[model samples]
Target: MTPFVAVVFVLLVLCSSTLVAHGGDAEAGAYMLIATSSMKPKASCSGHKVAPSNEASLNSTWAPLHLVSGPCSPAYSRGTDSSSTDDDVTSIAKMLDADQHRVAYIQKRLAGGDTSNGVAGASWDGQTTDVGTYLPASNVGVGAVSHVRPISSLNKMIGTTAAPDGTSAVRQTVIIDSGSDVPWVQCQPCPLLVCHPQRDPLFDPATSTTYSAVPCSSAACARLGPYRRGCSANVQCQFGFTYTDGATATGTYSSDDLTLGPYDVVRGFLFGCAHADRGSTFSFDVSGTLALGGGAQSFVQQTATQYGRVFSYCIPPSPSSLGFITLGVPPQRAALVPTFVSTPLLSSSSMPPTFYRVLLRAIIVAGRPLPVPPTVFSASSVIASTIVISRLPPTAYQALRAAFRSAMTMYRTAPPVSILDTCYDFTGVRSITLPSIALVFDGGATVNLDAAGILLQGCLAFAPTATDRMPGFIGNVQQRTLEVVYDVPGKAIRFRSAAC
Candidate 1:
């Protein structure tokens, strides 16, 4: 038997003292508190695979959520697969590092800063990190993994180099991002080297019968914000967008037919048709970005009339599993009403308007609130998809680390991995016991994180922010396996556990 099995009973006794789960109402002034005593502990640290949802039968309002490198992803390539545990850790770290640049850029914009190019907050450059190396672009057949399929279209002027097969129709994969606004794709004229290499064929506007560039005087051009590059020679609206990792896309602002599902199609969808793109972090499988931010140009705002400005997504716990992003609330929303917890969607003048902000009241460890002041988290935080690790203010993170370390005295400590300092070695252990951690929000709603959310490669899945004054980030890792609902019109966000 393993050493862990022999001491299983002893560990259970230790866990009884080390862990506490209780249920209680938020105190009148408590900033944040940990998990309730009534909460239940998970069986193990190894994440469980979630079953695929029947999105087709559910309706046209649903879209599948897959990792860019996951096996189920349309962009998946055997040579560049990031499904392994070690690769996941490396990829996540790079993403987290890239997110810091995003935070810095947002801060600069809030301070009324403009880039050297005479555009307000147009530059997404900062102390960027290397996202990683990718293999040469290769073809991958397109198909729907769940309710959603690749956005396919007929090509008009396909280049021989880009479309070696000379096919009339091509499908492209997009990265669903909630961090920023403006949807865009590399267009046909983006010759090799000018645009970053991509697995799918570049979007050929000449082939798209419904394609039309917006005039410089159009309202769409005005809504481009800092992204508006200016007018082309023929008065076509031009746009330039840069990511925190220094990747950039510059092209004409155009409208096209965007297919959400077989039955749902949005005509005259505004998007970018980039003739040039540059970045090392741009995944070859991803042809472009689908922005879900709160800005006027975001997909959510554009489709508000049809979907009530409401959307929800369930992120799979593991890469092999499946998750769904839905435009409208499902019928199950009524049944899961009892399980739903909601908090007000906050707005702050000191933060980027395009981001989703929420108020965080306190943090609890082992059913007890951490020793941190509420004022530390007074600044509203953004719930981000690209960011992999939850970032807390320095004071808050230190307190959390200290409290967690105190509660986990029974376990052996492991060396730190990159930014994740609080780690434990669970080698030879058959079962694991963890102290319950809970996050308390402004409306008395508490979210007890899943085990997978709490640990990334056996280390605490959180880090300190660049500065205590900067806003915090609630990242994708903590959002795993939960249905996160964004009710834009209602000005509220809801959470339901075990959604996948």
Candidate 2:
């Protein structure tokens, strides 16, 4: 182990008791504000205009163990050299280091400033537009999602079982992020070298009997967005989505089955079957990206009617363990409703359509509120659910750090973490009092945070925003241990602290 992590582990061992029984408040009084919500998900999967060939495959095909193959591979490489290390901490830390770049790329996209789909322009490979050979993109960054998740545990949320069909599921790892739009997989004719390399095998569209291209004139093609379209003579709706980290894929739009639940088969699922790619293989390290973003092309959108357009996820703090992303209303029914406190979803054409925007009203530190301006959390509409950004905005980051430092009682002069500026001395310390961080959202919904949610090792978790002009981002760190649910169609978001 590295010296820093070693020290942290030792400190954790010594202060185990103090941390386990820390006398922090668990504000259970805020349940009613979230419980009154009557919104829930209902099954309505039949309205889709699916091709006749894809119906049987969607309803009957069962690929059990589909997630088993997507291992959180410990693949780390700085430049030309890549290391497949089994060491958990080293792999995850390296992955996070790489994440900074991807985060920057995503921030720019969320900013919605990029107009060049790189079509009458240069593509990610710096190649001129070649509709005959490959669709091109420009200013594309080199990044992939499979490189993010840890391989310690498997996908328990997705089912693994044999079906009546002759074929069984091939399990694979997935990078679960709400910032992405549309689901995609490397398909037949996918090159191992140019494709985003992941532990999982590429999705071979040719093998699936139910697969077929989405017509160029179809509504689904239009929903995929004109920015992603590339036309060829008699093109079967060629579509492409440029990942912020610079990974670009241009391919035919195709339909197939995706089993989110045991019996819940998403038939005629629309996804990009990339025949052309550029930059890095890490992006395809897993089978493909399972997009959870808020755009019309996301997995959630196509399946919204089935689940009333609602989904929730809980990303565990453990680097190795995986969390659950539940689509539609949870089986707990009304019992699950009261367990969450939520904020409203925000939207503006300026923001990325795939993002989930939140209207953050204010942040309470200890007993005092910060001087953060409303501009940091600007919203034209009440935020029911916001895009789950992977990083924070610079303005918000600076403001939060200032407020937190002022409120902290144990402001030990420790070194800073990656993006976190507010840190305290965690060495040889026991029974330190932590400040109460209450996040106030729209509709007067306030979610009080606990120590376990923020403190990482000895440092405060919030970091400086990567970009100065970047907008607000509700990162995974802030949502840690919170069961956040998004009802896209209803334009609502609900959450509450839970064991997830």
What digit string (tens of lDDT, one per residue) describes model 1 on residues 1-500?
Answer: 11100000000000000111112222222222323221222222222244433423232265455444444444444345443333245554554455556666655655556632322122222222213111111122221111323323221111111222222335565555676678777787988778776665677676555578999999999988788998999599999876556667889999865554432446578888889877664544456666777888887788777677788777665444445566666454566588889999987665566778788889987778898998998776777655556888899999999988887787789887678899777655544556666788889988877654666666778888877777787877777667889888888889877665
Q: Which regions of candidate 2 deviate over 4 angstroms?
A: 1-25, 28-112, 116-157, 227-235, 280-284, 320-322, 349-351, 371-399, 406-412, 430-432, 464-470
> Which structure among the candidates has the greatest TM-score?
1
Residues 1-500, candidate 2, lDDT per residue (tens digit)?
11100000000000000011114354633111111011111111111111111112221211111011112112211122122211222332333344455445555555565635521111112111111011000000011111112112222223433222323443444434465666666666777666655443555554455567888778887776654565556758888755444657778888766544333455677877777777642332444445667767876778776666676655333222223444566343455466667666776776666667666677777666677776665532211111211344466667667766765654467654444455565445544555666777887777766454555434455554545445444545455546677877767788766433
| Poorest 10 consecutive residues by lDDT, candidate 2 | 5-14
Cα displacement (Å) at residue 394, model 1: 1.9
Superposition-based RMSD of candidate 1 using all C-alpha atoms, in angstroms? 12.0
Provide TM-scores for the models: 0.77, 0.68
